[model samples]
Structures are given as C-alpha cells and as structure tokens.
Target chain A: MSTADRKARDKENLKALILQGAKKLFLEKGIEQTTIRNIADEIDYSVGTVYVYFKDKNAILHDIHTIGFQELGGSFTELFTIEDPMDRLRKMGIFYMKFAIENSEMYDLMFNVKAPMEFIEHSEKEEWNEGVGTFNALKNTVAQCMEKGHFKGHSLEPLSFMIWGVVHGMCCLEIRQRTKGVKFSKPETILMDGYHEFLKIIEKL
Target chain B: MSTADRKARDKENLKALILQGAKKLFLEKGIEQTTIRNIADEIDYSVGTVYVYFKDKNAILHDIHTIGFQELGGSFTELFTIEDPMDRLRKMGIFYMKFAIENSEMYDLMFNVKAPMEFIEHSEKEEWNEGVGTFNALKNTVAQCMEKGHFKGHSLEPLSFMIWGVVHGMCCLEIRQRTKGVKFSKPETILMDGYHEFLKIIEKL
Candidate 1:
C-alpha cells in the first residue's frame, strides 16, 4: 500500500483501539465511573492519544453506542433471509432479547444511558439515527405483517412501539435486576418465559 | 395532645419534610446530583438532622421508593372495586402508565434505580416487600382473570410479569427519553397508544 493509505488505516485502527478500551472499562467499572484516563490506561495509550481520537467522554460514549447498534445489526443479518414476515418478526424478538441479555452493558448503553443522547443534544446533527434505524426495522416488519392481514385492528406505529416495548421491557427488567427482586417462581427463566407468553399472544394476533 | 404524643408527631412530620425535599431535588437536579446537603438545604434542616432521620442517600432512596409504591397502591384502590377481572386488569395497566408518566422520577426510583435495591442488599431483612406487594396485587388480579377462563393456556407468574413488562417497557423508554429519540409519529401519546395496543391483544387472549 502507499504511505498515505497506510497512515489513514493506522489512524482508523488507533481510533478503534481507543473505542474498544473504552467499552471494556464501561462494562467492568460502569459507564458513569469510567473516564478518559481509565480508557487510556486500558489501551496502554497516553491520555492525550485518547483525546486525539474523541473530544470527550460523551463523544466516546456516542461512538461506542453507535458501534453497539452496528453489532446488533450484524446479529440481525441472518433474519433477513426468512421469507415470512410473521416468522421473521417472532425471530426478530428472540434475536433482540438474546442480544440484550448477552451483551447487557452494551445494550444498556445503547438504550438506557443518557450520555449518548446528551451528546446528540449538543452536536449539530441531533437525530438519533441508530435508535431510529433499529425502531424502523421492527416497524417495517410489523408493516409487512399488517399487509399479510395480521394485527387486524391496530395502528402501525403504536402497534410496532408496543411490540418493541414488550421485548425491551423484559430485557430491561432482567438487566436492571428487577426480575430477581420480584422473586418469580422461575427467576432464572422468567425473561424467556415472559417472552414466550408474548409470543403466544402475538401468534394469535 | 400530650407532650410525648406531640413530640412523636413532630418527629414523623419532620422526617416526611426531609423526604419531600429530597424528592424535589431529585426531580429538579436528578438523584445523582442531589446530595444530602442539598436535601437539608431544601428543607431548612441541618445535615446532622437529616442524618438523624436516615443513614445516607440510599436510606432516603429506599424510603422514598416505599412511598412511591404506597402512592401507586393508592392510585390502584379504585380498580379493585371493578367486578370483572378483565376490566380491572385493563384499568390497572392504565393506572400504572398514568403513575409512571406523571411521576417519572419516583417511578424510576421504584423500578429502575439501583440505589434502593443496593440498600435492601445491605439491610437485615434483604427482602423487597414493596416490590413483592405490588407484584402480588397484579398476580392476584391475573389469577382472577384465569379463574374466569381468561388467559386459558398461560402460566400465571410469567404472564403477570409479561403484563408488567409491557407497561414498564413503554414507561421506561419514555422516561429515559428513548421514545423521543426514535422520532415516533405521536410521541406525546405513544405510551397510552402503545398501552391500548396491549389492551387489545389481551382482550383477544
């Protein structure tokens, strides 16, 4: 490769390294407790090097959050091959739930954490394209289900939002430790069990 | 009143005053930003006096969360009088959504915030009686619905939890500003509109 091309690639690789370190610290110590210095130490880079890639913690949080959406999208890539919208919708929820459960810290950062949204507020482009894109995936699937004559009496947007709420709610409760405190009969399996109940209801719908 | 009785009443009133002030600061400046000193200043009490009432911020958070449950129960009182379990369950969700949206801060403390749960972990009892009581209310209503031949093939606990998740997910998303970030067609009414979709699905079930 040419020297200029190699330099550009090196810069991109360094930026990715900083983001990876930031994500690790966010998971281990929590987003609120993790700082730029922590990220710098995690990657064996100077604090100045970390700052060269991102303006501040919020900028790092925003980038990590964006990466989370990309990872989630990558996970959903296989579902696109399914022909039936109804079948795809059911599996979409399962994928969403599994992703949330397995990568909870990242999921929390993507959906629940305020820093990324706060970052968006201060940035010139205020739209949350990551969230909008994810929501639209669900909305589009629901729209297809409607075309196939499911969701008979439901409005599209509200119905899609309701479905999103169901899965997000289950995942949020589990991740936040609310499920364990409630002492469900099947504490370990309540997230999936509750989700199955939703699947049953939606199948009939 | 006798001197002893007057002293006891005054103490209770002062404790309530402190909690009210803390909640106000929690709402205005956020829970993390509001210190014990802020609470004391808000109520015109000394920091030591506030300490005399509660050990730390967690203690205050735990107590406020208990009060939030009580307020929720108070809001639920009228629903209990409905003869039909299905009707009562429908209205119960409505009441829950209303309480969550109207008192977003308190609702976050009751369900989402980690401080109260952390306090419970360190306390002697370690049982979340408040969460248990609230869940039992929903469980009993769902039990009634099952007895009436509604929810014919669903397990009681998971189904109840799913119902809880539905409302909670919508409220959490809205409270955490996820709803607005997604750019919903009707951001203002999405919570209720999403809830209405849930009501429709359960009605069929």
Candidate 2:
C-alpha cells in the first residue's frame, strides 16, 4: 500500500482502539464515571493521543453509540432474509431483546443516555441517523405485515412504535433493574415470558 | 395540639419542605448534578439540618420516589370506580401514561434511575412496596378482565408485565427523546398515538 493509504488506515485503527478502550471502561465502571484519562489508561495510550482522534467525551460517546447501532444492524441483517414479514417481525423482537440483554451498557448508551443525543445537537447532523435507521427497519417490517392484511385497523407509524415500545420497555426495565423490584413469579425468565405474551397477541393481529 | 404533637408535626413539615426543595432542584438541574448543599440552599436550611432529616441523597431520592408512587396511585384512584374491568384497565393505561408524560423527571426517577433502588438495597425494606402496590392494581384489573372473558389464553403476570412494558416503553422513549431521534410522523402525538394502538388491540382481546 502507498504511504498515504497506510497512514489513513493507521488513524482509523487507532480510533477503533480508543473506542474499544472507552467501551470497556464504560461497561466496567459506568458511562458517568468513566473518563477520557481512564480510557487512555485502559489502552496504554497518552491522554493527548486519545484527544487527537476524538474531540471530547461526547464525541467518543457519539461514535460508540454509532458503533452500537452498527452492531444492532449487523444482528438484524439476517432478519431481512426471512420471507414472511410476520415471522420476521417476531424474530426481530426476539433478536432486539437478546441484543439489549446481552450488551446492556451499550444498549443503555444507545437509547437511554443523553450524551449521544447532546452530541448530535452540537454536531452538524440534524437527525439521529442511528436511531432513525433502526426504527425504519421496524417500520418497514410492520408496513409489510400491514400489506399482507395483518394489523387490520392499525396505522403504520403508531402501530410500529407500539410494537417497538413493548420489546424496548421490557429490555429497558430489565437493564435498568426495575424487574428485580417488581418481583415476578419467574423473575429469571420474565423478559422472554412477557415477550411471548406479546407474540401471542401480535400473531393474531 | 399539645407541645409534643406540635414539635413532631413541625419536624415532619421541615422534612417535607426539604424534600420539596430537593425535588425542585432535581427537576431544574438534574438528580446527578444536585447535591445536599444544593437542596439545603434551595430550602434555606443548613446542610447539617438537611442531613439530620435524611441520611444522604439516596434517602432523599427514595423518599421522592415514594412520593412519585403516591402521585401515580392518586391518579389511579378513579379507575377503580369503573365497573367494567376492561374499561378500568383501558383508563388505567391512560392515567399511567398521563402521569409519566406530565411528570417526566419524576417518572424517570421512579422507573429508570438507580439511586432509589440502591437506597432500597441498603435500607431495611426487602421489597419495593411502591412498585408492588402499583403493579398489583394493574394485575387486579387484568385478573378481572380475564374473569370477564377477555385475555382467554394468557397468563396473568407476564401479560400484566407485557402491558406495563408497552406504556412504560412509550413514555421512556418519549422522555429520553428517542422519539425525536426516530422522526415519528407526528412527534407530538406519538406517545398517545402509540398507546391508542395498544388500546385498540387490547380492546379486541
């Protein structure tokens, strides 16, 4: 490779390394407690070097949040191959919940935390492309289900939003530890159990 | 009132005053940013006096979290008067969503934040009474609905939780500004619009 191309690739690799370190510290301590210095320490880099790639903590958070969406989108890629929209929608909810449960800290950063949104506010971007893209995937699936004569009396956006809300809410409650306080009879499996109830309802719809 | 009774009432009044001030500061600034000093300053009390009333910020947060439950419970009172279980359940969801949207910050503390739950862990209470009581109200309503020939094949707890997840998810997304990021067709009405979709589905079930 040419020297210029190698230099560009090196810059990108270092940026990814910094993000990987930040994400580790974020999950270990917490997003609020983790700092740029802590991230630098994790990756054995100077704080100055870390700042060269990212403007500030929010910038890092925004990029990590983008990475989180990319990961979610990657998991969702297989759902596109499912021919039946109804079956795809069901599996999508399951996959979405699995992702949220498995990578809760990242999921929290993507959906719940304000820093990423604040980053968008300060940056040139006018919209939350990550969030928009994910929501669109769900919306399109619901639209296809409607075209197949399911969701007989439902509007596209609100109905899609409701479906998203059901799964997201369960995941949020679980991730935020609200489920522990609620004392479910089967606490360990309540997330999937509650989801199954939703599946039953939507299958008929 | 007698001298002893008067002294007790005054003490309770001062404690309530402190909580009120702290809540105001929490709403205006934020829970993470607000300190005991800030709470004392808001109420014109010394920091030591604030500490005398509450051991720490977590205690204050727990108290405020209880108060949020009280407010939510107050809104739910009228729903019990409705004879039809289905009607009551429908109205209950509306009341829950209204409380969530109208008192977004308090709702966040009640459902999403960790401080109040942490307080519960460190305290004598082994369970979240506020959460249990509120959930029971929904559970009872759902039970009645089942007895009245609705929700024929669904289990009570998971179904109740699923319903809770739907509304809570919508409110969470809206409060966290996820709805804005997703570019809903009618951002202003999406919460209720999404809720109405759930309402319609449940009505048939």
Any residue pairs clashing in model 1, and if so which? Answer: none
Error of 2 at B87 (Å): 0.5
DockQ of each: 0.77, 0.83
Per-residue alpha-carbon lDDT of candidate 2 for residues B40-158, written as tens digits (9 for 90 to 100): 88888899999899988889999999999999999998888899999999899999999998899999999999888999999899999999999999999999999999998999999
lDDT (10s digit) by residue, model 1, range A87-186: 9999999999999999998999998888889889889976999999999999999999999999999999999999999999989988887887888877
TM-score of chain A of each: 0.93, 0.94
lDDT of 2 by residue, A1-205 (tens): 6999999999999999999999888888889889888999899999999989998888999999999999999999999999999999999999999999999999999999888998898989999999999999999999999999999989999999999999999999988888999899899999999999999988788
Shift of residue A3 alpha carbon in model 2, Å: 6.3
List lDDT for all candidates, in order: 0.91, 0.93
Which residue pairs does candidate 2 place in steric collision? Answer: none
Instruction: Give candidate 1 regions above 4 Å deviation.
Output: A1-11, A46-49, B1-14
Candidate 2 regions with alpha-carbon error over 4 angstroms = A1-10, B1-10
